[model samples]
Target: MEFLQILDSDIRPGGLIEWIPAAPGGLGAWHRDPRGTSHNHEQHLRSAHDYRRATRREGGREAWLGLAVEFDQQIDFPAVQGALLAWINRHEVLRTHVRLDGPDVARYTTDPGTVLLRRSRIGWYHDPRLLIEQIAGSFDRATTPMHWPAYRFATVARAGSFTLFFAADHSLVDGYSLVNAQYELRELYQAARERRPAALPPTGSYVDFSSSERTAADAADDRHPAVAVWREFLGGADRLPPFGILPAPPTGAGPPPAQHSHTTLLLDDDATRALTDRATALGGSLIGALLAVAALVYHRHGGCRFTTLMPRHTRHHVEFHGALGWFVALAPISVDVSDDPDFALALERTMVSLDRAREGASLPMLRLAELIGIPPEPKFVVSFMDTRGVPGAVEADAGAAVALRSHTYADDEVYVWFNRTPGGLRLHSRFPAGGDGPGEAGLAAFLNEFAHLLASIAAGG
Candidate 1:
């Protein structure tokens, strides 16, 4: 309450209070072992903050948010900057910092905070070919655990035009938030540039939602039905089998070069509608269609039974939707399709398995990691996430604005990642470049071929 007046703003009846009370530092706070997961997490946070500070000094505001905006018409940068500052001053979350005590963590306020917004504009290019290279090279590596308040924005130019890029810490926001923010900012930029009033929407802040969700999640007691569902689904299978044969040791084999590749498969609006129509005709949902197709792909590539992991958002469960942080329960779905199997039946089984998994969704990812003895590094992790876009998830922020973007890291720890895109129900497999050690080109080709195979099945060909 005392800090509320620090920014020269009137206090409101309902607002998030910066009440950390000098608790433990979040960086050092560990729910599990202090040396293993916690240690690595701590190091990552410190290094990330330090790197961001350095980039800020060099690139200015844009470096902080990793944002670069280009204007077709002339606009005043300083005015825009001023407006942003005022907006920040009024928002308490922007000026807040986290304090780390050994075992407990708390949020607090800090003067002259390290986080700052920077801007730059570029015009004209000396060497046309080098322009894109320079701009592309300028972007900072993406961060994880998205947090919105920590985001920064910057602008730069090399050719006769300019663009804006936003760089922000990953802890505060998620992909859904980034999309909403972009739309809002575009409206704001247009209004300011055109000297017209901006039309912004009213929405709740993530911080507020997160706080409430945590309380509710902690209070839930009914676990019978959910647990039973999982028990039935898992049956007597104690563990999931590795998809492929473990390559022989070096001298002759050292695990046939890891088959790693990532690509996105999308179903546009029309395509999605058609897919849905087809599903209804077959008595299934769009998700069922996608899963059946994915199962088919796995069968072809692995030549054996495989399990895919899907996160249970618990949207249907009154206890979970709209919760902040991951309420995801990993449900390993097994699909064994013969050379030619019933697509509709395959879909029905997949859907039923997932539903049961969600019902018993208390198992966390880390728990699974420990149970499987998944070494520090893993060959691949096949995962699927389904969350509503910003439009449906959170009300639009009218006071400032919101955008949603995501930065993820799998490294060698994870080989294959399967995700769902916003466009339609199509699944996307994202992989890091240089995933295959040598003969990268050959590995890339294999990935392409595999995707083509999947796409073919999706078309019901």
Candidate 2:
């Protein structure tokens, strides 16, 4: 095949190579050499969180983001390998290595051509789940400030089909960046197969964004409006609310186990459509409605107002749309269900609170913790990703079917992940099993109530 022939000279299986530079005076030239760059505020926050987690015995395992994409038909392995190299060459974030120069500072260095593309093959009978788990488990085995690459890629073959698995450090890419990279990889593969150059356009690098973020943070004063907003949100509270739905543990019980349990909730198509319509009529988003339902459920179960760490995509600039990097930040949204028992009113209030949060959405979570003198970790966190609207489905010329699979590791006391699938909205909740939080039975009951509340709100009750 032409693709195979093209890859013969470019693909280096389980070896390091000097990445070939694309045409000069284009996007390819933007990061042709390794250079030191300062870490952005968000990057600093992630680094600090990772460092803190490292202090625990089982802490560092959750730092990796794992993805697996399967194709129904056989794929050109070498061509795909070449595409991976090309994709890495285009994004400096993939080539970046983080090192702590001081107690509080992390410096990023980009090694342009030294990326090691490790490759391996799995048998047809190999279990996919075990492979994914193995990759995720070893993510933090090695210490940082080392020369290892930020990511690992592998190809697996199973009876005329193939699966591409990727695992990377959380500091390098977020959910949005992972999706963007998959899309770009598909395009690059197609172009490579056709013996034509990839049509990737120029975009700003993470280095540039980091420099700009540092400048903005330095220019802002302690009394800045955003900082004040965060301070007020904390309300002079010494500690954030607990995430458990059950009663609190006794004092001196010791810290909870670091492991988590997962539960999922699914809505049918009709229910999802109804909720979408209701959210539209209420002048809010489905995510907002869900959050409102969560707040109501937590209040009814725990009898108190609570705060959640809500993530916002920080790629507001046009140049960041197609770029791959960790461009996400979390905003703390406090919900008080006692103020309004009415579901509609509660949803409205939730929407308003979320809107206000957008005002300082760009602020780093670590900075907010420092300003308020609160613990950096939030008890409850919510994350949403809508992948149904991606531009195109991954399809190879050989008529192979492609599907993207994403997996997240949780480090919080409670984490809720929402994904918009073709059938409906899917919710996955991960919470500490032996912690002060809800146990298995309590969590199941909470999920049931959340579903019921969501349905009621969508029905305009």
Per-residue lDDT tens digits for candidate 2, residues 1-461, read: 00110101111122111222232233332333333333333444455456567655433334455444545555776677678877777877766555544554444444456454555433232444555444434444421223235456666554565656555555666666655555577678778778789877776677666666656655666676667667666773313433344335535535444444443436765888789888878887888888888778877765456467788887789898777766776776766776546667777878887887775565666555555564665666788877555444223211222222223233245567776655567676655454354555676677888888787766666
Q: Would you list the C-alpha lDDT of every candidate in the order shown?
A: 0.40, 0.57
Candidate 1 RMSD to the real structure: 11.6
Off by over 4 Å in 1: 1-71, 82-96, 109-150, 158-161, 194-197, 218-269, 311-340, 360-428, 432-460
lDDT of candidate 2 at residue 73, scale 0 to 100 = 56
Residue 191, model 2, lDDT: 83
Residue-level lDDT for 110 in candidate 2: 46
Tens-digit lDDT track of model 1 for 1-461: 00000112111111111101121343233123121122212233444545456544322122222222334443456545543543343233344433344544344443222334444334445553454333323332322212223444444332343344454543333333344444545556666666776675444333343344444434444353544544443454313323322222234322233223333445554566676677777777666666676565555554344455554442343332322222224455655565456667777777776666664455333333333322222234444444334442222222122222232322332324333434444333333334324333533444555456445544665
All candidates' TM-scores? 0.59, 0.78
